[model samples]
Target: MSEINPSQITFARVRRRLTKAQLAKELGVTSRSIQNYETGSSAPDSETLAKMAKLLNFPQQFFCIEESMPVIGEHAASFRSLSKMSDAMKNCALSAGAIAFHINDWIEERFNLPQADLPDLSDLPPEEAAATLRRMWGLGSAPIPNMIQLLESKGIRVFSLAEEAREVDAFCTWHGSKPFVFLNTMKSAERSRFDAAHELGHLVRDVYSMRHGETRGIEMEREADAFAGAFLMPSESVVANKPPAFTIKYLLKLKHYWGVSLAALAYRFNALGQVTEWGYRNLCIEIAKAGYRTNEPEPMEREVSQLLNKVLDALQAQKVGRAEIARGLCISVDEINALTFKLTRLSVVPADSSIDLVSRRSPGLRLV
Candidate 1:
């Protein structure tokens, strides 16, 4: 009975990663028509609205919801490979961020989540900033067992990047005072951990620097990369535990110890002058030859959200299943799962059919 909200058309389209022309073709209409529908100059009739909802995989009521879609502007977010990513990829990731805001809000309203405890470390160099954070958190050159858990404990909201945004390694942004990180779970577990740390670097450095009129692009990215390397593999630990040789086997052992990719370890070692430039290049070549660049060897288990797990368990205890949550948001259960790290385990019966919940936790996957 509600009138269609034109902006919702755009939100659904972007969330699905479809451009106006592509969606128009699917709907057997002109791109101009789709634009008009999105801009509120005109509205899609019931039939067209139904098709749009179906193609976008959103419920029909979603397009009629009165609430505004939360927007994270391009300038506000720190995206990995921002220059190389297509507009669709960036928008898709940003849309996922909007969904994350909704889910985070829903959780916060009912429970007392951790408050942000991050300090401003923009004035210091990346290594010093990393060390300062380590000292502040009482982590002295020790390897982090779980980056996601640690970040959540510090009141950072972490979510998984859907498969549609796989090209985007990860991204972070501030929604008001709170920080949110989106990690590409499709990547190897080691790479994902680095991504998590990389975003944390942005939270500590880039977010504060931006307020003081600093540019928010590749320069910040370079600094964040350095921070992540130092945060994950402390310089003192790396120097004290320098290997006798930098062979692939030795690199593999170190990779497991540090819980980072081989290339990351190689770069860190080379940066510290332990390996010559020529030696670094050769190590990279050997790593590529072993297909380590594309495929990870001896992967650790993927880290998920401990906070979200607890939240879901609490919700289950209250007899509020995922279906109720999805209905409250006027979205599909699958959409909720996509925004989450896919961690909800209670059985849910969607409007269309039933979905069996199963554990996605990787078993017996230890650092080898």
Candidate 2:
């Protein structure tokens, strides 16, 4: 076991959104002492380490583990509603993602996860990029049956944001060679689908550009929104399916076929010139009046993570469960659930259940 690193204390405190003063109060220490510990001028005693671990809900061993991977930089992550989010909240979310990367590394060692198979279309226009990805993925003009599954199949790791901030719709970043897209699943399914596609746009276009020192501003956001609209409802399909006259009623009815929000469909129509400027203006007004802007009508079912479900199933077969995994990683089961899209089963097993026994004591455990 390694000695406890002072930096790990700072990382954990920051991840929990606790100020140094706040953590010091919780740990019954002076703020300056917390600072000293964080800055490596002092180290926590064993009793202090126990108190810190219990307070943070992290295993004591976690503080001793070397920090192998750094949290992704803010510039590298493409955040939706970036302006509305507090810096602390953003850090909390990103720290969660960093923990997820650690969990993913553990899983990858056990399971043969899919490899990323996406083209770099950083130079192409958003519309062309969407169309190109569609062709590349063999999606053509068909509506994606399951966006999460499609992404998982292509090896883009998708995680649900447990950050209680509603303003943060979604974000995407490329960690090492793999792409990670985090979605705010609290939104309606329609909006979540759009968010996934929008982040995909960032992953495909903005991530590479940002690495090359390209400045992403409002123009990038607009491009991502446009890409999402085009990707979810392809121009060819929209052209074929759109009515002669575009209206909120027509869009509401047509949205199910495209599996997008009515607002998204209307905006796509306006962009494609299928709806006149006057018609689009009235359509937007009508949509907002009907509360379609904030809430989607007839929302599709939420897309669950297919890859996570399979991984859990495989682990179950090997007599491994959430508690075991969490204990092994020196994290909480709640953290595991957050990283795995809340797919981890939480129900208590019967005392007499054989499955519980198997989970508690499994011999020769290996991933199939």
Candidate 3:
């Protein structure tokens, strides 16, 4: 009904790392036209707008929003690293493990967030540890729907941290009592969801596992993963009567709700004593052969995180847009959009390495 904001479209496309030249060719426009649109001196016709939306895989309305925010949080430090790193490697690294983020000191710098003076979670048994966390956050017995939002709600400062550290296999690590969960942003919503839960394992279970700079151990990772499994799918609710035959269709149906890898679900079933070890192994081979692992998985956080929804809802309710929030913080709009709203409300170290200021509420707020 209204004209699109060309600048917003260009920003979103570039944030996705789609080049102007790439989109121009796909949309049958000259690169110079794309440039003009990005600078906001000119606009696209309806015909061009349809093509742009199709090529970018975005709704045309997405470009009509006045303010555009970076989907992931970015800092000057992160942007500098991105310029130096290969995108392909970044993709692989994020999809891989915890080893990737260390390439640019994201871990080191993120651990330095002002509120990260982690309380000691050591010497407590698993049950006691989880309970202490619940008590601290005032959580009920019900599972946390969104791991990222849940962590952010509790002031844990969850971030995607999928910067180009290509060598990493999918793993999470804690820095100075601050926990970071890196999900390969490129992975399907399914894989990303499980990765989020897996990282949640590291956060909730490993509060006390650190000593003298030791990283998360394999056994510790496993126990946290188990917690994530039970927490996410709720083994009691999902476990079938008469062991509803484990077929590919059955697994797909399970994945629809669980957002866990078939392999992980396969393992969970074995743990529940629903399937034999041999059946589990065979199922794994079958699922793998069927191209389940390589195919992108769904994201659980989109469905689960009440934290994220609440933040967006609260902001929408307040009519507090991203630009106003960023202007209030005197930081990039990208930071506010990338992380959950609670993280912003909490005092965080500002992105400016050049300026070190206290993290507190600003006295005056509202966009000019």
lDDT of 2: 0.79
Alpha-carbon shift of residue 147 in model 1 (angstroms): 0.1
Sorting all predicted structures by TM-score, with the top scorer first, yields 1, 2, 3
Cα error, residue 251 of model 3, in Å, equals 2.7
What tens digits encode model 2's per-residue C-alpha lDDT throughout 143-201? Answer: 88888888888888898886543457888877788889888877888888999999889
Candidate 2 lowest-lDDT run of ten? 359-368
For residues 1-368, what per-residue lDDT tens digits would candidate 1 score against the true structure?
49888888899899898989999999999999998998889998889888888889888999898887798786678876676689888999999898888878876766778878999887889999999999999999989999988998888989888778878889888777788999888888899899889899988977655444345867778988999999999998998888898889888888989999999999999987889999899999999999999999888777777888777766665566777777767777776777674433444433442322222221121111
Window of ten residues with lowest summed lDDT in model 3: 72-81
Model 1: residues with Cα > 4 Å off, grouped in runs: 209-215, 342-368
Q: Every model's Cα RMSD, please?
A: 5.5, 4.0, 12.9
- TM-scores for the candidates: 0.91, 0.90, 0.49
TM-score pick, better of 1 and 3? 1
